[model samples]
Target: MTAAKTETFTSLAASVLDIEARSVSDLKRYLDANFTRACECLLACKGRVIVLGMGKSGHIGGKIAATLASTGTPAFFVHPGEASHGDLGMITSDDVVLAISNSGETGEVLSIAPLIKRRGAHLISMTGNPQSTLAELADVHICIAVEQEACPLGLAPTSSTTATLAMGDALAVALLHARGFTADDFAMSHPGGSLGRRLLLHIHDVMHKGERMPLVNADASLSDALLEMSRKGLGMTGIVDAQQRLVGVFTDGDLRRILDQRIDVHQAQIDRVMTRNPITISADVLAAEGLKLMEDRKINGLFAVDDAQKPVGALNMHDLLKAGVM
Candidate 1:
C-alpha cells in the first residue's frame, strides 16, 4: 500500500507541474501587439511604473515591482486597497500604472481604474479575461489567461499565478533591455546582492595592501620569502626589485616544486627561482575578473599593481571566497 501511495503521489505531482509549465509556455502565443504596446508604455514612462493588485496577484505584483526596480525600471508596488485611501496622491500624470488581476475584476484594483485614468496616468491591465471590465477600461490589456488551474478543484490560483508571474518577468526583462540596463547599473541598486559583489568589488577591495601584503626584495633568500608568505598567511609572496617594482611571484606551488628539486630555501635568492612575469591585475579591475584570471591560468594567488608595475596589493582564492565575489 505504501508503494502504491508513492506512485499516486508522484503521478499527481507530475500532472500539476505539467499544467503549470503549459500555462507559462502558452503565454508566448498571447505576446502579441498588446505585449509590445505594454513595453512601449513602460519604456516611455518618464516618472515611475506603479504596480497594483490584490490577494495572490498582489504577492506576484510585489515581486514584479522589485524585479523592475532592480533591473533599471523605477517602480514600486501599491496595494490597490491602499490606493483608494491617501495613496492615490502618489500617482502623477507622468506615471504608468500596471494593474494585475487573474480574474480581470479584482474589486480593489478595479475601484481605482477610473481615477488612475483621470490622473492622466497610462493604465495597463493584465487579466485572465480579455473582455473583463478592467481590460476594457485599460489603455492596454495584457491577457494572462491559462488553459486551466493546476489545482484539481479548479478553484485555487495555481497555474494562473505562475503564468502571471512569468508574464511579469517577460515584461520586466523586455523593459530592462529597452533601457540598455547594464550589470553596473543593476549592482548600484543591489549593492548587497551577490551580483553586485561580483561587479562592484574590485581587486583592491579584497587584496591585502601595504604592510599586509607578503612581499620581499628580489635578492631575498627563498627562506626569507617563505617567512613573509607565512607571516601574511596569503600562501604567496611578491618578489620586488630595488626600485620596489614587482619582478616575479613566489607561491606555495613553487615551494612544492622547489622541494621536489631539493633547492636549498636558505641559500637560494627569490629572483632565480620565482615565476617571472606572473599574471597580474590592476587595482581597479573587478575582483570577478581577477578570479577569472586565476582560474584560467590555473593559479591560486595574484598581485594587483599600478601602471608602473609596483605591487600595491596581493590576494588569493580564499580572499575572493570571503569577499563574496566567487
Candidate 2:
C-alpha cells in the first residue's frame, strides 16, 4: 500500500479507538445519583418505556428499545418527528419516556417535550448537553457526553451513540436482575428462536418412542440384531431382557468389533457382543443437557430411560442437529 493510504488508515483506526475508550470512561461520571433515579423510575413504571429520538439518535433508540424489550422490560421506539404527527397518542400517563439526542436540542424532540409532560409521563433525557432545553425540561437527565467523535470532522455521533447504547444496556440488565427474570421467561419471549429450542425442548419432545424405537432382545442372534438396526436406520439398537428392561446396547461399532474378532454374526448371541451398562439419559431432561451429555461422553446416541429403568425412547446426534441444538 502507498504511504499516504497507510497513514490515513492508521489515523482512522487510532481515532476510533480513542473515541470509544473516552466514551466508556465518561460513563463513570454519569453513574451517580441521576442514573440511580433513572433506574428507580423505570423499575417503578407499571407501563412500558417509550423511547424517542430523531436522526442518528433515533436509530440508536430503536436498538435500545429492542434490547430493553427482550431483557424483561417492555419498551418501544417512537420517532420524535412522527410523534408530533399523531404518534403521540401511543404515550400515556402510566408510561416512562426515554428521549435521546446528543445535543439535547434536536428540534423534533424539543417540540414533543411539552406534550410528553402534559400527558403526565416521566421524561428521561439522554444527551451530551445537560443544560439544553430537552434536558432542562426532563424529569431526569442522563449525560452521554463524549470528548470527541471518531469522525475527523468531529460532527458525527460515533462516541456519543456508543455511550448511549452502553447506558441503555446497563439499565436493561439491572432491571432484568431486579425483576428476577429467569431463563424460562426469556425463552417465552423468544419462542421461535434457537435459544427457546435449547431451553424449552425436552428429551421426550425429540426422542423416538413407541414402534418408532429400535430394539432387539439380548438373547437374539447377532444377525437378527443387525437386521433390527438396519430396519430402524438408527445405526444402533437397544437390547432388552424378558422384562422389557434395557440390558445392553448394540451398535455399528459393536458389529465391526465382532467382525474383527472373527465371531460369526449369524451364530453369536447379541448379549455376548453388545455393550453392557450403556449410558442413558432421563426422558425429562432438556435437549440441551442431552446434547452436552453426548458431547462429554463422545457418543452419537443414547437411550432414554423411564424412572423404572425401562427403555422409553432413543435419541441420536442427528436428532439434536435437526432440532437446531447441535
lDDT of 2 by residue, 1-326 (tens): 89999999988899798879888887988898998899999999989999998888999999999989998899999998889999999999999999999999899999989999999999999999989998999999999888888877888778888888998898899899999999988988887899999988999999999987899888899899999889887889999999999989988887887788999888899999899999999999999999999899888889999877789999899999999887
Number of colliding residue pairs in model 2: 0
Provide the clashing-pair count of each candidate structure.
Answer: 0, 0
Runs with alpha carbons beyond 4 Å of true place in candidate 1:
none
Per-residue CA lDDT of model 1 for 1-326, tens digit only, reads: 69999999999999999999999999999999999999999999999999999999999999999999999999999998988988999999999999999889888888899999999999999999999999999999999999999999999999999999999999999998989999899999989989989989999899999899999998899999999999999999999989999999999999999999989889999998999998999989899999999999999999999989999999999999999999
Determine which window of 10 residues in candidate 2 has minimal summed lDDT.
Answer: 148-157
Reference-based TM-score, model 1: 0.95
* lDDT computed for candidate 1: 0.94
Q: After superposition, how far is residue 180 of candidate 1 from its true place, in Å?
A: 0.7
Give all TM-scores, in the order shown: 0.95, 0.96
TM-score of 2: 0.96
